[model samples]
Target: MQGPAVSGEEEPRPLLRTMLGDVLRRNRREQRRTLEDVARAAKVSMPYLSEVERGRKEASSEVLAAVCDALRVELSDVLAEVGRDLAADRVRRERVIRLDVALGRRTARPARRSGDTYCLAA
Candidate 1:
């Protein structure tokens, strides 16, 4: 899915839910645990936990904490990992944009589409 509109242009931004889900899934796999096990431990339904892991749901803080507890992980640690990933991604994207401009492959302001809207990394 696309991220929020920037300069009237739609650009795909990394979704927090997706990133959090990835980290949760990775941790679960590393622990050699199944969805059923974690769900039961977290006191949540299997389907709901699966939805959260698939980034299809925005779990509440209470639920996130419960899941973290079930996984034997700290919510703060998980959030810190997410923050690091996001910062790295932003740097990579900006570097690519700068390189494209330097190579004359693109400009900070590209030609506008028929909608009279232009896209630029925000």
Candidate 2:
């Protein structure tokens, strides 16, 4: 699902399922709760809930709402946290590029196309 990233390649985006799973697991752990407890409260099967948390399965909107309710968290809040994480990831990637330039580790390279635009060679 991933390819070797070359110099000047566009930043890769994280999979939505993976990000959602990470947030769900974080929230559950923060409340010192177990998957069984939340699944029971949400009326979702324990194994299904486990799969969702592991990103092995994608949950429907109804399931997501139910899980949020069981976790005592607002669905909107969960989404907001995911948004924040994505933004942070973008910033972190940009920082790494800047640091590379600052350390003079980058050398002259041919122009590289990133998406629809081409980055001029330096």
Q: Which is the leading candidate under TM-score?
A: 1
Tens digit of per-residue lDDT, candidate 1, span 9-109:
53467899988998899899999999999999999999999999999999999999999999999999999988988888776544223435445575556
- Candidate 2 lDDT (Cα, 0 to 1): 0.80
Runs with alpha carbons beyond 4 Å of true place in candidate 2: 1-11, 95-122
CA lDDT, every prediction?
Answer: 0.83, 0.80
lDDT of 2 by residue, 1-122 (tens): 22233455766787777778789989999999999999999999999999888888999999999999999999999999989888888655552233345455767765767766544232
- Poorest stretch of ten by lDDT in candidate 1: 1-10
Instruction: Give the Å shift of residue 118 in candidate 1.
Output: 27
User: Model 1 residue 40 lDDT?
Assistant: 100
- Flag clash pairs in model 1: none
Instruction: Tell me which residue pairs clash in candidate 2.
Output: none
Query: What is the Cα-based lDDT of residue 86 in candidate 2?
Result: 84
